[model samples]
Target: MGLEPDNMSGSSPEDIVNAVFGHFDPKNPLTFKDEQFNSDPILSEKALCLVYILGADTIQFTDDRLIEKLQTVRQRISEKEIPQVIVMTKVDEACSLVRNDLRKIYSSKKIKDKMQECSDLVGVPLSYIYPVKNYHEEIDTKNDIDVLVLRALTHIVKIANDKLLRSDFNKEQPLTYKDQHYSCDPELSDQSFCLVYVIDANIVQYTDDRLIDKLKILCQRKGKTDP
Candidate 1:
């Protein structure tokens, strides 16, 4: 999501934060979409993960108000179990060691300190923060820069997959089968599921009772075999 210019001044931190996360709140629903107001409902529900792009060189000069808003956003996303990552760009401009030798990113104390500062400010873990050089002057893509970006993307996809697997409308309710209820399994993660039943649309209403019973039996067997 893009933030309006500071001169616009009409959008408050609370407004922006609410527009993003409030859609998931059943108590207070945003019923309308306003481009001028920068409001889009159901943003949180549609987004698989949140990615915060920060300039590594100017992180120290980040505005206090923006930081506070981000902290609140982080808290809400954490409560919902959505993954958030920070891509700290312009790493070369942030540290001289990394600028001279891209391989020294890990060993560069300055880069590490900047990453830690970002984590402390945004409430995001250090592991989820990636420092990389944004392609500004380079006419060609560099392997070192691509590596850092790819690593962050890989982590984001993995965590997002975990969230998707755990997501279900009935997750809060107990698993029930034929009046039998079972507690939701908390250990479920990285699981895959695919169960499809297709019948001719024209004949769907005329499906035999015996066929329906067979389908139910198949569903029960599939559930039993699922890990």
Candidate 2:
């Protein structure tokens, strides 16, 4: 139900909640945890909506082919599962880099169009994309991290409450939703974020722009690239 820096060694419930303190604790070494799923197999099998988040400190958004890479990330998410949210945190940095560039590239219509393109290619709905604020770069501090933890916890509680509500009903089968092969009977939580695309006023550059351009061209040649 919560997200934080983890040591990778399993721990008790309290350990999970306080794990953030351990990693972000100034006294501890620079710590990082791979995205993981809780080992409750019963819960594991249930397809929980994924929260895809991009972070700061680890994010490097600047320069060439960034949009192309973003497209690729969108592709990955669409391929994986319907995303609960696609958080683009450290947005201040993104904005700072290219004052108006980010907006220009990420217009509402443009985004929808792009997502639709990705969905068509990946064969999924474009409705699942969501965004949130979860970074601290300009007004740098750990508050952003705190916000991320709280948001994750909120999502977890919602899932738990759903289970509680279903238990009260005593139904043979619990209430759930489906996305392709995904079944939300068991709750699952997934987190993700963006990295390395530089944006400046009126200009957005991709770190891997050249490569994506070439690839985009290839896709275009094959009659893709409508978004």
Candidate 3:
């Protein structure tokens, strides 16, 4: 969603944040077509993840009003438990080494610091921050630039997938293992059958020891070893 300029009639930071979270009112003058999802229940419910694209060179120069809007957006994302990642574009412009050699992105301390700065400002973890060089002045595709962009895209897709998995788990019936169906409800007696996911470093970690033990027992009953 795009926000109006600061001097525009309806360009409040709160309105911009609301637009990002699918909470903006359709009748608002600043509202755009994409921001009108809040009017449709199905469209509003379909937003599974949020990607905040930020300019690497411009973040440090961002105005206080824009930063306030970003913080508001962060709050909404946290409140909804929506997975988010910051795409730090224009890395080449931010760091001289990256500009001279795109392959040096991972090894460049300057790029790393810029990524950390983005994470700090956006309230996202460093692991979720991706630094990429935008195709600004290039006529031909470069391998280094392609690699960086593809890597960032891959992470974005993975995060979206995880969010979808979590949403599916919430909406679907409990899974069945060993011919026994279990309820995913936390308050139910069969809650032990449910698996809880701890997302870290882009990996999904199952933290339910009881569920693991139960699976082991089930395997042993079938005369099979745990894989």
Candidate 4:
């Protein structure tokens, strides 16, 4: 899902908080209910990744307040282990060398400077920052422009896909017992497992109820034998 605020430059702390957490105060960090994000139709769930789109030429001109707000949002999202990337647009407009020859994008000192500035300002790593030219004025698509956009998209998709698969595995494979009482149903279909590890003499007494419960879940998802 995508969410675009009406005025990013003038966005207040409440606006940013509301956009991310669905309301002013979230009960849990990065946890959301189906009805929580009803304020914005686009925000149905917690974001898998955050993408900040900025103009390459206007990075220096960005308001200080907006930068601070973005930093705050980035910190909150990072706490949940969500990935973030910056897409620096209008690279051709920012650098004369890149404007003349798109191949010079990587070699241009000005473009590199702008990207570094954006990285430093937004607190995102330079590697996650992608510089590209928007297809605004051009009537036809260019190969170089396409290459830059495709590379950025490839990385973004890989990260998002990794997170999605991880979340699915975590939800479905673990924590089968939900209620206060724990019970196993033999009639239920069994899940496949590949490995099992037995407790050692020294560790047997050290395993408590909580630890055993965790081990039981792991064994159920990862072993062929019953714990």
**Candidates 1 and 2, the one with greater lDDT:** 1
Candidate 1, residues 1-227, lDDT tens digits: the string is 34433525544444444544544343443344533332443434455678888888988988786776677677876776778889899999998889888989999999999999899988889988988888888898899989988888888898778766666636467457543344444346634477788889999999999999989998998989877
lDDT of 4 by residue, 1-227 (tens): 22233344344544454555444334432223535434443334546677889899888987776776778778887765678899999999999999999999999999989989989987899998999989988899899999999999999988877776555344445445784433566444554445556779987987889988988887665654657
lDDT of 3 by residue, 76-164 (tens): 77876788889999998888987888888889998888888888887989889888888877899988888888998998988877776
Please state every model's RMSD to the true fold in angstroms: 14.5, 17.2, 7.9, 9.8
Task: Please tell me which predicted candidate would have the highest TM-score against the true structure.
Answer: 3
Candidate 2 segments exceeding 4 Å error: 1-40, 43-47, 52-107, 121-124, 133-136, 140-227
Q: Where is model 1 poorest over a 10-residue stretch in terms of lDDT?
A: 34-43
TM for candidate 4 is: 0.61
Sort all candidates by lDDT, best to worst: 1, 4, 3, 2
Question: Which window of ten consecutive residues has the lowest lDDT sum in model 4?
Answer: 1-10
Shift in Å, residue 77, candidate 2: 13
Candidate 2: tens digits of C-alpha lDDT, residues 1-227: 32222434223233322232222332433334523423222433433444444443233322224333444444544443333344344433434432334433245453444444434432334443332334334475555455545665676557445644443342455444543434545454432222233346454453367966866675565554233
TM-score of 1: 0.63
* Per-prediction TM-score to the true structure, in the order listed: 0.63, 0.27, 0.66, 0.61
**RMSD after Cα superposition, model 1:** 14.5
Q: What lDDT does model 1 reach?
A: 0.74
Clashing pairs in 4: none
